[model samples]
Target: MSASYAIADCLTMLGRNLKRLRRYPSLTVMLLAVPIVFLLLFVYVFGETLGAGLGDAGRAGYLRYVLPGIVLMTVASGAQGTAIAVATDLTQGIIARFRTMAIFRPAILTGHVVGAVLQTMLIVVAVVAVAVLIGFRSGASVWEWLAATGLVALTAFAMTWLSVAMGLVSKTVEGASNLPLPLVFLPFLGSGFVPTGSMPTALRWFAEYQPFTPIMETLRGLLLGTAIGHHGAGAVAWCLALSALGYAWARRSFNRERS
Candidate 1:
């Protein structure tokens, strides 16, 4: 297809997936609920104790510190739904029907990726709104806000693509759902809940170097005025690398299934 035609086809497929999302609002609500619950639980229940560890900054300080990580977690949680949706489509023979149609082939997958990213973005926004209501504050400038937004978008895109690959590789919908569970919890292993410095040596090292840590740190710097250091570079590199891997894996698996 020509460039414009391909873009149009992708948008058409995206619209179809979005319509499905609209028709079943329950799925979106369920997917959104997990992060919202976590946000509330952590900010209200755990915030006091956790913030104490950060010194006189207290619960309010912990809220600001953790909000960025929570936002990223929201994206990760939404990605699970993407994997389930893709697996469902595959198991239900929807993909097979698409393969038989004359529409652009790549659009089939593009549609899913785009829809998942958008859904995750909305969930992130809702979670952030809740965080603000509960006293999450940021002194980030306009440029900082824009950069943070870009990083979040990049993270969502990368995670959505990774979920798509997981879904394509899974034998069933349940397996797909289970496969992305690690993504949801990765933030905990990083600097999300508490400082990595407080962990054991090995765990601390791992947490410091993990993909999520750098992303979380970058978000913290952008939103909460924390120092960026090398985290900005690290986040960009991880996102690009993961996105490339996900694209290759998803495409290879998709083509294999079609054949």
Candidate 2:
């Protein structure tokens, strides 16, 4: 009964929000468009400027090198939308109104998170389709490909929860929306584009230890059908640890919002 009640409340909230999309259809299009533009900008405009090393290695190799960065970008984009939507709700006293209702109080926010997750899944699909259309195919088996995509999706889910926490804590929409930038930057310093050994010592140290590299390493390995070179265990651990951390923080924020 409790689970059903929570789900229904969330779905109802999701339905209402979906309907609101028709008010300005461009809003949803913009969410999908920004990332596609980035893909083009990086893969074409700056592709040569970034250097020949990544490209000389073949299109597949280039995609392999930059895949993690793109994955991070997609999730970051989704999370930003999640935070903004949540902030909008809080700003307009929609949350306060819901508090007065008899339905599950927490379900309102949970609903938003669920809706964000669904949106993120859609973003992932669109990204992969665009990627494949651009010759970003993985030579791995079908199952391996699914595993790789699933790993990235898992990271996105954890990130969406973290954004929910940001939405609950930030004082303004700008604060809420842009908070994902730091998280998104993590992959850049890691082994996402270049090997950690090639980086300066300080950066190398950070890259070797930062959660992004391992996640990227893991995803790359899965996508390429290779084993994560050295930090495979650490990468898997970071995902679990980060998810737990994000969940704990989000739950605290959720509780505090009610208080």
Candidate 3:
């Protein structure tokens, strides 16, 4: 089929999955609450204690500084849910049924990825809103805000693809459930909570050089409307590279399952 037709079919499948997800109202509510809990816990508990130089700014400024990372953590955590849901479909043989339908070979997988992205986007937005209510503000213009949101959505998209691949590969629900933690751990190694300068020499260098630091730096800069950090270019490159790698891997895995 033509690419356009395939995309359309995928979108239709995406809508169906969205409905399926929405049917679990309690799950949806829980998903919404997860970020809120994290936002409160960290903002209240460690916000003041987190950074050395943080002031009236108080926990509030520091909270703004940390919001993007929390947003990312929120996305990372939600993708584990995606992995579990996908694994459920696989273990129950629904994935096999969908494969047989021949609607579009990759459509079902696309649907799941799209839905995960949508779910994470909503989660991110809700978390951001919560941040605002708790005293976050942005002086960014329409375009800057759009750019920041785009980066977040794209970051979530890459993560969702990674989750899809994990779901496909994992034999057990627990395997799928636990897979995301390691990926999430990588960010904490960077400038997410602490300044890279404060870390040990080797760790500071590594943390400053990693993907999440730059991405976080970029988001913080753009959202908070500061300059991209020293490593911003590297971060953008890393994100795009990761997204490409994730897309290719997910496509390969889906094709293998179909075959």
Best by lDDT: 1
- Candidates 2 and 3, the one with greater lDDT: 3
Query: Each candidate's TM vs. the true structure?
Result: 0.98, 0.88, 0.91
Q: Write the per-residue lDDT of candidate 2 for residues 175-200, one digit (tens) a residue.
A: 88788778756767888666788789
Q: Kindly provide the TM-score of model 2 when superposed on the true structure, using C-alpha atoms.
A: 0.88
> What 10-residue stretch in candidate 2 is worst by lDDT?
46-55
lDDT-better candidate, 1 vs 3: 1
Q: Can you give the lDDT of residue 208 in candidate 2?
A: 88
The model with the greater TM-score, 2 or 3, is 3
The candidates, ranked best first by lDDT, are 1, 3, 2
Positional deviation of residue 152's Cα in model 2 after best superposition, in angstroms: 2.0
Q: Select the stronger candidate by TM-score from 1 and 2.
A: 1
Error of 3 at 172 (Å): 1.7
Maximum-TM-score candidate: 1
For model 1, the run of ten residues with the poorest summed lDDT: 34-43
Poorly placed runs, candidate 3 (over 4 Å): 2-5
lDDT of each: 0.91, 0.74, 0.80
TM-score ranking from best candidate downward: 1, 3, 2
- List, residue by residue over 1-259, the lDDT tens digit for candidate 3: 8889898889898998899888876665776787688778778988877744654466877888888778777777877888887888888898899877757868878898899888888878888888999888888889988988888887888888888888888888888888877766766788777677878999998887777788888888888778885656766677688878877877787778768
lDDT at 144 for candidate 3? 82
Off by over 4 Å in 1: none
